[model samples]
Target: MAVADLLALINEVILNWIRLHYFYWANWCGLSTCTTRYLVAMAVADLLALINEVILYWIRLHYFYWSFLAIYPVCSVNDVLRYAATDCSVWFTVAFTFDRFVAICCEKLKTKYCTGKTAAVVLATAGVLFCLKNIPRYFTQKPGTIIDNMPWLCAMVASYYTDPGWVAYDWTDTVLTPLLPFAVILLLNALTVRHIIVASRVRKGLRGESKGENRSDPEMESRRRSMVLLFTISGSFILLWMTVVVDFVYYQITGIGNNLNESQWIFTCVGYLLRNLSCCTNTFIYAVTQSKFREQVKSAVKYPLTSVLRRINKSPS
Candidate 1:
């Protein structure tokens, strides 16, 4: 929990900076407006998820139990929002993956589907759907205790574990989130790799690279850049979430109950640790994969100091 708090604090600061950069200086950045919109949405979603899920819920419950956020109604509402924020973050990544897949593999559809207007519409629609989907979570929570007739600390309703409807909802929710996104991302990446390989071979032949003529294909180069960003972000997501996926499958298969043994507890904790870690990794991925993004960061960092210096020079010292 301490590790999670530290990481969440660092992530909060960095994501806020990244969000500001992407939001205000978006036009000046080299990425397409469509891609820029997705990245900005991702940063916001990640920030909300870290704040609500980790700091507000986990850290506050453990370290600052007296806070009013632990009270009934508010705690339940926070849980719903936390789930929605997390859903938005996961699905937004999947949406961006699909967008890139269209841009790279479906040349005929890319122009229309990969525009800023389409991106906005798609993101807004997904955001609304996920928010609605998580509303039922509010009812599944009961108070951990009642103090002076006031309920405190949200806990799962007793029936949630045994009720058929709630069980189905839990399964559906899990499947809808990391599980479905996991499978979809992997499938899309596989198809993308196959397409790129075939296209490269055909283009190479057309360019006479097969005839001992060495030439640079600008089209392939462009595709390569797009692929780098897509794969790095998606790949990092998959790697980080692998433990959580495996942990889910194991518990389901074994039919484990709440009384987990020590080993099971450790495994679950590690899975959650990695899951939280995923929320912080995309910014670093962008820094490592995109040179233009690095340049934008540098420019954003300089803007503050430059403005202060310019003002100081204008004043009589």
Candidate 2:
């Protein structure tokens, strides 16, 4: 393998292992909440996506960019799974944001809709929908002769591989995947914040009447926890996804991606890197926010290491 391929392989393998660890640990010993059922689904989808992406990266390294630089009409299993996972991850965040919106903005709907079972159903449905949605993308890859002069034709492949037939679904995916959800999240969070403030003021108004009662209601505490989690999720999603949204919009407006300048190519790479990293960050978010998650991780780590140390000492004696 070339140096580039080796580096790519190492980086991908390391990230995927961490991602898998996060998923395995969180699902196995840490995560246990109705509200976070989406995390379980996200972790599963992320691991599958990351694994397939590593495969695709390996193929691209060996076959397309390395040797067979002249093949056209290329359809790849990698592209299919990549598109599906990318879409699934985006939609899951949207569904989660919608859940938060309802829970904060409308109590009646929250009661009816935002259950663990409901979240599981929504996630399962999203996984199936995205898998079906990107089926068209399976036939979308076609090798194009954009940069026949570059060493590996990196810029051209970036543009051509993304040209998954600019059909209705593509258009919708472009808009709704991150753009619409981003907008809705912003709007909903604004409403949620407003709701929270108003509710706080009302609580103050009732301070005299409820002087005997504790200020921290359990329902209110639950809301606060969910809000914290949502903010963390949304913050990272925005930070990572903003680049993609900008890249897509720039492509739509200027159509200059196929022959991207050096800086634009760099920007594209950074955006994609951020998107790939998004899958790994959620597990960290859970670890940071949930005591249960942290405790489980500590126990998981300590017990194994202690056992290994004990065996080492015993063998030496």
Computed on alpha carbons, the lDDT of every model, listed in order, comes to 0.86, 0.70
**Per-prediction TM-score, please?**
0.85, 0.71
Candidate 1 versus the native: TM-score? 0.85
Which runs in model 2 stand beyond 4 Å of their true positions? 1-33, 58-75, 143-169, 209-217, 294-317
Clashes of each: 0, 0
User: For residues 141-172, what per-residue lDDT tens digits would candidate 2 score against the true structure?
Assistant: 54444456532222223434354655455578
Clashing pairs in 2: none
RMSD of 2: 7.5
Name the weakest run of 10 consecutive residues (lDDT summed) in model 2: 150-159
